[model samples]
Target: MKKINLENKTILVTGAAGFIGANLVLKLLHEVSRINIVGIDNMNDYYDVGIKEWRLEEIKTKADDNSTDSSWTFIKGDIADKEMVDKIFSQYHPDIVVNLAAQAGVRYSITNPDAYIHSNLIGFYNILEACRHSGDDSGKKVEHLVYASSSSVYGGNKKVPFSTDDKVDNPVSLYAATKKSNELMAHAYSKLYNIPSTGLRFFTVYGPAGRPDMAYFGFTNKLLKGETIKIFNYGNCRRDFTYIDDIVEGIYRVMQGAPDQKNGEDGLPIPPYAVYNIGGGRPENLLDFVDILQQELLNAGVLPKDYNFEAHKELVPMQSGDVPVTYADTTALERDYGYRPSVDLRTGLRNFAEWYKKFYID
Candidate 1:
């Protein structure tokens, strides 16, 4: 393994206004000094653009509050635009690149396959191509390329905890298929260009200022509107609900410890590439998770104390692109990075609920 010193390094983070990306920028600003950080985001209206803007504001506030020798630059642009991607690479010449700008949400992929292909596939290709040529002329190469994968790649496998070694050719949704493709593309790029790369298969990540498309956030919205919230698989789902903070911490740790390039017996360069599952090892039942979420809503004053939760929920059969369970085997992450998600569902939901009250209700 190779240890990367983040201090004085130039890092480019795509999807800078996103939930994970914003938090990661904040973390970098707080933890690493004398760093030059560049961020880019399309700021699509897939969810509320307000949320993305708000996250950017938070990052800006943090950058201002920190009196250290760190800097942040944000560009509103799309990675799918090869010209724009190439411009950023040529101008910044970042040492580390984190690609998190892909179109998210499995169900959304079913209705809008074009978005997935455009961003997930083509955008990723552009990033890889740019990384491949970053060293040309500039003589400065990207040290590590980290990108996001999804647990949905596990598909309908009956595995308890999905491992990195697990077969993921069978993706249930276009989103999953695209994420799987990302891992494959990264592997090929690593082999061809000897670029150090890592892919994280994130489980159901949740927390404050999270994506509103996620279940907990959407459920809060529905409950607040006195509408029914559908529980998929007739309340038989189990999910590894990893918190945003934990996910950010995992990414931070993984960024500094890139896989080392090696030479094989055939006198060929082996790819310095790896993939790991970043998740809370424990899986929580969907029904129990909802129960805790409601309790937290009440505790946070987002929901009335006497609200009738039982009347606002309905059990429904699984959707077309939905799976019954998503459990991640994070043993490899812990083994390699010495870290695993530790936040529990209740605490995570509580934080989200409190944030909801502050953001909307209050």
Candidate 2:
């Protein structure tokens, strides 16, 4: 992998404590020289604050290594707070801004829709405003703004291998709706301010120290406790399960290679913005995924060999905001960046099992 030069560049990564944010920050710090990173996360107990703190601890340990003079600064703040966001932008004047903070979870949005509005809507607005105004004082505008979108925006479309050109106006859930809205808002901002914004519609990202609310992590816990794991939609679903490392790698590549103006029919730069699907591109069956996960847990010593795994799985009706299948079309990403996620599901599951054993079982 050819590493890009990011020396002397200050970058701001929101949702630093989240799974993807932490991974991206660690990768950037180790790869870039003389780089300064400012990470902000409210550290809400949406899952476990301890896990978030542990991720920060790992980042701090790497940053303190004397071999690299690169700096990592963390701030406990919310993106919705305009005053605090403005202050950080003014102080750091980051060359690149990556916004990964948002109210996640699809089903949760059904009951708690307001959270999505506050974070995804108001919070993202605050980030855009800060990025736009950051250069006013120092005349150093943010070169690129990369934000997280989701594959859920595809909704109930019957299309295989969802592409950026596909119409995503029909969002099934509030979470998907907000994500789609983010893309639209980013397009407008990119056209108006030339922010060179890139929105990544990530598929099902899972790996070590992932969110507990996710099916893989939650099912692991249920299996360990000898409890029945609810297999929603009768385990007839398919997901493009992207590994965390793959996602981090994709983000790093897209960050370095910002979107450029493509000539439109009028022979002028079109939108100066782009959206790409960062996913495994290979969808795995839900039941097959669970079977591999069970074997991995046993291999990691988190599950007994004779455990009643079959009896533990309870088939249930489809849950709201849950899609039957999701597949990604990575042609755009491959053509532009020569990058494609190569992590297989079994390998990724094994890595997660190892981490789960060490973190919870040990």
Best by TM-score: 1
Top-scoring candidate (lDDT): 1
Which digits, one per residue and each the tens of the lDDT, describe model 1 over residues 1-362?
A: 99999999999999999999999999999999899999999999999999999999999999988877899999999999999999999999999999999999999999999999999999999999999999997999999999999999999989788888888888999999999999999999999999999999999999999999999999999999999999999999999999999999999999999889888998777999999999998999999999999999999999899999989999999998889998888888888899867888888999999999999987
TM-score to native of every candidate shown: 0.99, 0.96
Which residue pairs come into collision in candidate 2?
none
* Candidate 1: regions farther than 4 A off: none
lDDT of candidate 1 at residue 202, scale 0 to 100: 90
TM value for model 1: 0.99
lDDT tens per residue, model 2, 118-192: 999999999999877878999998888899999999998788989889998889999999999999899888776
